[model samples]
Target chain A: MDKLRQHIEDITALSDEEYAYIKTFFTAKKVRKGQYLLSEGDDARYEYLVLSGIYKVFYIDEQGREFILQFAKENWWMSDYEAFFREKKATVFIECIDAGEVLVNTLQTREKLATEFHKMEHFYRAKLTNGYIALQQRIKLLLSSTPQERYETFSKMYPDLGQRLPKKIIAEYLGVSRETLSRLYSR
Target chain B: MDKLRQHIEDITALSDEEYAYIKTFFTAKKVRKGQYLLSEGDDARYEYLVLSGIYKVFYIDEQGREFILQFAKENWWMSDYEAFFREKKATVFIECIDAGEVLVNTLQTREKLATEFHKMEHFYRAKLTNGYIALQQRIKLLLSSTPQERYETFSKMYPDLGQRLPKKIIAEYLGVSRETLSRLYSR
Candidate 1:
């Protein structure tokens, strides 16, 4: 709860009462390695804040190839955001790669927090602003960087993630082949 | 001014005074075809709401390949969003592909609006929410869809875009080779 309190403050300064209100929405869960956190076609009932552990968020392509979209570690949030926000079926799979703990909150609970607390909405807006900035930067990186450059940058950005996940998964995230990732690593 | 009023109403219900306050900040501009609305390293001063014409937001890759990140038409907004919000130098480029009309507002103006009018923050929050949802869907599409599927989906999403731009540019936007785009078009 202390960490979650700090996380809420990191977005926008929250009042004690407001923080207490938000606390009611989040429930802590311990997930084991190789456990599935979310699967395709299911309604995304909750979004999770990874308290500890490595989690991969990926989608299966038409040819049944898995494409890793993101990895969430401690302090990071993971969920099929599209499904979670849009009230749609999940389009991605989230699996725990390392045993982890997360604070989970559902859409209804999140909305209630926003409606009941102005500070909460401010926090969410600020978070969405930063998320948009990150997504904008990622789109630029995908457009501008070569696969090797992207791989190098990814390794630098998520130092722990590179070591925790398989090269094949990183390759998919960087839009490259495993052989290409090997060559890049060798270089 | 009438169009601006209509646009605001389309997004959210605003009071007459609030609408007037917003209108005061925006200045309409006509952008000629082939003009660069924004350039790399420039101060991204304004966010433009497109009233007409096509604009491609893109960046040049290491190998000097141009990759299109987004194409904006009527009613869509374009800016080097990172720079506009952070008051930093722009990394992305926004160019007019046709003679364009837009209503432009600067960060300073937006800040004033947010500070003076609480409703403006709510309106901006709503805009950011839609943008967030769209971006999440785009990432999902990028991860799950093939280039051909992307092209088809993009065409469906913006039916007018295919007729407005050259095939090669659209191919770049879809992250496919020109040859592959030609084959997809044939099919």
Candidate 2:
């Protein structure tokens, strides 16, 4: 797709012929809101690049408490990555928050493309670098920031998300109670 | 730099000449225990690949409480990654827990190597892939696991590290009080 082309080109340029060949590896899928892309114990066979909507990657604890790990938006990637990369059964769930299409690629394709195209390898490394930084930032936030500080950081970092997501989800992401989130909101 | 060669070879094969050229980009340094490899406000110019020794990458909160983000052992990588990649002032501290040697690498070197050698690109990508998976595991633990569960996971993941690290530091890493860690240790 043109979108997939644009996404890869944003990291490393590819010729029209190269793009055509590379694009063959990805398959498009339409997802409805509330549909599950991945569930615990399922084989995580593919990783997704969102074309249009929001999604959440989460895990459920023994007591059935759900904890959100991260959100995926348009142009973002999402998967139960541990399972996807290691070929292990999924320990997390990926659910569609808003209906949209995503382009899916399997591990075999990722390896084949990278092995064939040096530029593709470069593209993947670049993306991983950014993802690594983001996860580090999240760890720092989780380890130290106060609840109010977290709310402020979250709103600042994802202004659109803050406005669009339910406050309940926002509170869960921040590791705060609904009442605490309400107090912060009133301020 | 045989260690460096072996590290790369573990992910992808390289010719002798290629390995020689690639090794030039890395410089080895001997670190002393208690010395700080990186500190808040430093430029975070290099990422370190441990050859021998232990290191902690951490941050101090406004309340002056230290929070450990991660520990680096032999074959592990450590850096103020946000600052390393973004070229920003460091916001974290990297301190040596045991004196030993490490291979230090610059961003310029990493980018040059990856761009010049496709194998190098694949090598870096593979390493980042593992790093990303480990960070995801950390996030999952932080969000849901109980202290006892976290302790068990940590011990199982790093049996040697469990024996070597001070319980205080282990407690910090697990987000548990030292007393809680002591209780876990007793059991």
Candidate 3:
């Protein structure tokens, strides 16, 4: 897709021929709202590059409580990465929050692309670097930030997401109760 | 050093000539106990690969409370990655808990190595993948796990770290009070 080529180009340039070859590794799929891309116990065979849509990556606990790990939007990548990389069954679920399209590639295809094209490897490495930094910030926020601070930081960092996401889901992501989120909203 | 070469080789094969060139990008440093590799407001230019030693990556909050983000031992990489990647001042601290040696490489050097050698890029990407999964697990623990569950999981995951680290540090890492951690230890 053009979006995929643009995303890759943001990190590394690719020739038209190279882009054509690279595009073959990915297959596009349309997802409807509430559609589950992955769920616990399924083989996490593909990593997705979002073209347009919002999705939630989450896990259900022993008590059936849901914990949202992250939200992926356009140009974002999402999968049960632990499972995907290790060739294991999924321990998480990825559900489409809005109808949209995504390009999916298997780990084998990803590795092949990276190996065949040095630029692709560079692009993936760069993306991973950004992902790693974001995760580090998430850990810091979880460990040190107060609920209000967390809400404010989330709002500031993802103003668009804040406006688009339901308060209930936002509360879950912030690890705050709905009532607390409402109170913060009022303030 | 040999350790660095071996670390890289674990993920991808490299020629002696390649390893020789790769080693030049890294500088070895011996860290004394209680020495700070990085501190808040300092330029976070280099990422360290621990050769031998224990280190804590942490930050002190406005309330003067310390939060441990991660602990690095041999063969592990540590940095104020958010700052290091962004080429900005650090908001976190990395300090030696036990005297050890580290291989330090600047952002420029790291990028150069990755760009010059596709194998190096693959190695870095694999490392980031593992780190990303670990952080995802940490987020899951923080969002859903009880304190006791956290303590048990940490102990199980890093039994050596459980024995090597101070109870206070472990408590901070788990986001539990010292007394609570002690109680968990007793149980």
Candidate 4:
């Protein structure tokens, strides 16, 4: 609860009343390693904020190759974001890479909180802005950065996550082959 | 201005006073085909709302291969969003694909509108949510869809954009070769 409160404050200054109101929406869940948080084609009803452990968001391609989109660690949020926000079917599978605890909230609960509390709405809007900005940076990196540069940069950006995930998972997220990543690392 | 008003209305219901306040922030600009509204390394201080024509938001790789991130048509917004919202240097270029007109608003003006009009903030927040959802969908498509399927789906999703932009441009946006796109289109 302290971490959640701190997370909200780090993004935007939240009043105590606003924080309490926002807190009502979240329910804690413990997920075991290899358990599914969200499956492809499921309705994504909840957004998750990791309290502990690691989770991977990925999809199986036409050739049945798994491509990792992102990994979430403690304090980070994870969801089949499109489906969760747009009321659509999930297009990615969110799996617990390690046994983890997370705070989960449904979209309806979030909207209710936002409507009932102006400060909460402002806080959420700021978080959304940050999320959107971060996504834009990632897209730019994808376009402009070489795989090696991306690996180096990713290491710098999220060293903890980089160390926790397997080499192949990181390789796929960087849009490189495991073989290519190995070669880059060796060099 | 009419299109801009309609665009705002599509996202959120705005009172006349709110609309008038927003109207003061927007300055119109005429863009020629192939001209840039934004470029890499420049500061993105303003958001552009298209009133007429089409624009491509793209980044160039080291090999000088252009990757289109998105296309904006009538009533659509185009900018180096990462820079615009985050106050960072732009990493993408927004190029007009046809002679066009757009409404430009500086970040400062946007902040004022948000402070002075709650409804305006809600309107922008809705717009951000929509963009965030679309980007998430793009990430899902990149992870799950075959190149041919992606091209087909993109055509279905933005038929107007497909018709307006060159096939080569569309291919890059879909992360495929022009030859591969030609092969798929022929089928």
Question: In order, what DockQ does each candidate have?
Answer: 0.53, 0.83, 0.89, 0.47
- Which candidate gets the maximum TM-score versus the true structure? 3
Per-residue lDDT of model 1, residues B62-179, tens digit only: 6778888788988888898888888899878999998979999998888677656555655676678788777766766765677877887888987888887899989878778899
lDDT at residue A75 of model 1 (Cα atoms): 77
Clashing pairs in 1: none
Which lDDT value does model 1 have at B74? 84
| Position B45, candidate 4: lDDT | 84
TM-score of each: 0.92, 0.97, 0.98, 0.91
Better of 1 and 4 by DockQ: 1
Q: Give candidate 4 misplaced runs (Cα > 4 Å).
A: A143-146
Candidate 4, A95-127: lDDT as tens digits: 998997999999898777766655556667777
Interface RMSD for all numbered candidates: 2.0, 0.8, 0.6, 2.2
Candidate 3's C-alpha runs over 4 A off are none
lDDT by residue (tens digit), candidate 4, B17-100? 877868988999999998998889999988998888888888887788888888888877778776887799988889888998
Please provide, for model 2 over B15-47, each residue's C-alpha lDDT reduced to its tens digit, 9 standing for 90 to 100.
989987888888999999999999999999999
- List where candidate 2 sits over 4 angstroms from the true fold: none
lDDT of 2: 0.90
The full ranking of all candidates by TM-score, starting with the best, is: 3, 2, 1, 4
Using TM-score as the yardstick, the better of models 2 and 4 is 2
RMSD of each: 2.2, 1.5, 1.2, 2.3
